[model samples]
Target: MKYFAVFLPMLNEEKSKQYRGDHIAYLEEMDKKGKVYAKGRFTDGAGGLVIYIAETFPEVEELVKQDPYVKIGAREYEIHEWDMKVTEN
Candidate 1:
């Protein structure tokens, strides 16, 4: 199963900046574990978004919960299980 995590950095830019390093580290770990598929921030002056491919929704949820952004209350996330039918190589 695949999961899509829609992360919205709340009005806590300062906190996000403070924890950015830890957050990136956590994301790198996830990538190494082959759990992350595609991830990027909303460079449109918005928030961020991340997509993960996992064994289950619970696994993805736990992963998201471990993010420094979420832990530090700098961002909140909404997760949805996905059924992807197409992709660009």
Candidate 2:
């Protein structure tokens, strides 16, 4: 399985706060299920980014579609399929 990074460019601060808990819960579930390798929010606090390892693009897309932000239409995402060229550990 290859890794892909999904970038979410969010807009409404109020809406994001409203859905924050649910979003975190969802990410936790995904991580537990081994769908998400790692995830985090931007330092500037504008949006978020998540890295997922999956079998195919469709699977990645399906997982991303489950995000609360996407469901509520509070944010939009750009998905980039990545090839891991190097790792220290």
Candidate 3:
């Protein structure tokens, strides 16, 4: 699986709040499907981040489009491909 870091910077906090529950539900659903690796929000209310695992970046992009945040235009996302390094020295 490939990893992607989704950087979400809040665009409309009010709108985000309105759809927060749906957003969490979406993530939880993805987690059940083994799509989400990790997720969290910024304490400062900037936005949130989600680490996703998928076969390809386009696949991840498709998943992101389903997020409430994206669907409602509450935030903007920047997707970065991540390469995890393991140390077994």
Candidate 4:
């Protein structure tokens, strides 16, 4: 599987907060399925990011398309393949 980084740029904060519960549920489900590795909002409040493990870009794209934020048009997103990881042991 390849790793993907999803960047969500919030379009409407009020709307986003309203749907945040649903969005969290979606992410939790993905996490249970092992499709999500990590997720969080940026410190500046611009938006959030989700790290995904999927076979292809289309696979990740489809996942994002189902997000509550996306469904409500509360955010726009960009997805990029993450091909490398570094860790200090």
Report every candidate's CA lDDT.
Answer: 0.81, 0.89, 0.95, 0.96
- TM for every model, in the order presented, reads 0.86, 0.91, 0.94, 0.96
lDDT of 1 by residue, 1-89 (tens): 66675565565888988988998898899899888887888876466888887888788888898888998888888888777778779
lDDT of 4 by residue, 50-84 (tens): 99999999999999999999989999989999986
**Which 10-residue span in candidate 1 carries the lowest summed lDDT?**
2-11
- Cα lDDT tens digits, model 3, 1-89, are 99999998999999999999999999999999999989999999999999999999899999999999998999999999999787998
Q: Which stretches of candidate 2 lie over 4 Å from their true place?
A: none
- Model 4 vs truth, CA RMSD: 0.8
> How many clashes in each candidate?
0, 0, 0, 0
Q: Which residue pairs come into collision in candidate 4?
A: none
User: After superposition, which runs of candidate 1 have C-alpha atoms over 4 Å from their true positions?
Assistant: 87-89
As a whole number from 0 to 100, the lDDT of residue 10 in candidate 3 is 99
The TM-score-based order of candidates, best leading, equals: 4, 3, 2, 1
Each model's Cα RMSD? 1.9, 1.4, 1.5, 0.8
User: Which candidate's TM-score is highest?
Assistant: 4
